[model samples]
Structure formats: structure tokens, C-alpha cells
Target: MDIHEFLELPHRFRWGGVGGDDCMTFPASWALKCVGVDPAEDLRGTYRTREEAHAIVDNYGGELAFMDSHLAKIGAKRVQHPETGDIGLIKAMTGETAVDQIETQIGAIRFGPLWACIHPGGIRATPAEFVAVWRLTA
Candidate 1:
């Protein structure tokens, strides 16, 4: 699938859980298509509630640590500026569970100037400065 098609895949999922159609898996949809690797493949279906998700994040020592450790092993390189097809992370002001102002970041994909992630209704371009991003290679 091309970038346009890849970006559209998240609409098919109902957003919820740690790995089903949540933050990690949403952008992961693009990685799976572009490089034949699913970033959240291991975590999918492993947790279903907010607390369980927090435990998983803790297991990896924090959210960015988990993303950095995982994305690197799969051929993605962290970049200062993300282009289209790059995986980006940003701090989200979601609510109380945010840790040290990190990982509340929903992993998203760069689509020109906007970063795409799963929203309540569907996929939408969210406006938040990326704290970190990973460039994918084929």
C-alpha cells in the first residue's frame, strides 16, 4: 500500500485498548505497510485497560524508552525532523495519567505538515510539536 492507503487503514479500527487501535498501533499501521514490520505487534491484545497500559509502559522504563528500544530494532532511526512516512511522538495534555510530560504522546505519522493519529471518530491530523520521531527505511 502507498502512503495514502496506509493513512486510511486506521479508520477501519475502533479505537481502545493498549494495542488494538490505540496510539502505538495507529501509526504502526503505516510501518507495517511500508517496511513489513508492525511496531505494536508484540503488544497487541496484551492489555485492555488504562492501568494495564501504564504497567506495560513501566515495564520498558517509560514510553519513549519503550518506543526507542522497539523502533530501533526494527530499522527505524530517530530523526530531528520527520518527513512523510516518519513515526513521530509528542506530549499530549490528555489528563492526569501523564508522566513527567512524556508518553501521553500518541505515536503518529507525518503527513506533510501534520502528524496523523487515531482520534475518537477516526484518523485526524493532530497539531502538537513532536518530542521525538523515527525515520523508517524500506
Candidate 2:
């Protein structure tokens, strides 16, 4: 799918939503598509809740650590400036948890200055300054 189609993918709270929603899955799925991988075919049934997300991050030490580990897993590297198609580990002032705790989100760069992913109202673009970018290693 092209950027427009990817951006138009339905948003939901499910872990790996083809039509579901969640921060990580939305962009993670998109990143996989950039590499010619289908998330529904490869990444299925994982990180289904806020607690699960926290546990996974705690397992790797913390948010940044988890992001690093994840990036490494996908062969992506941290970048000072993200271009289109780069992944971003975003730290927004807002987060979602069943118990009202904070959380982080992952999104893909759709263009200069914008990181696109599933937000509360649906898929939207956030400022690149709001995230730490990671690009796939060449």
C-alpha cells in the first residue's frame, strides 16, 4: 500500500489491528510494509494491553531501552533527523492505560516534520519534534 492507503488504515485498540488500533501496531505494521513484510502474516498476537506493554518495557529496563531493543530487532538505527518512512519512538504528554498511567507510542514518518499513527480520534500526524526517530539500517 502507498502512504495514503497506509495512513488510511482503520484505527483501533487491538494489538495488531488490520482494522484495530494501538500506537505500536499501527506504525510497526506500516514499517513492515515498507520492507515488503505483512504484519498480519508475520507479527500476530502480541502486546495486547497497557500492562503487557509496561511489562515488556520493564523487561528491557525502561522505555528507551525497550525502544533500542526493538529497533535492534528490526535492524533499525537511531537517527538525528528522520525522513519519510523512518520509525519514531514518540513521548507525548498524553498516554493511555487502564489505570490511568502513562504510555508511549511508536509511529512512522510520513513526510518531513510529521509522524503518523493511530491517535485517540483515529490515525493522525504528530510533530516529529515529539518523537525520537529510528530509521531502518541500510
Q: Tens digits of per-residue lDDT for model 2 on 60-79?
A: 78766765666677677788
lDDT, model 2, position 41: 38
**Stretches > 4 Å off in candidate 2:** 16-19, 37-44, 95-110, 128-131
Clashes found in each candidate (C-alpha, N, C closer than 3 A) = 0, 3
lDDT of 2 at 66: 60
Write down the TM-score of every candidate.
0.82, 0.72
Best by lDDT: 1
The candidate maximizing TM-score is 1
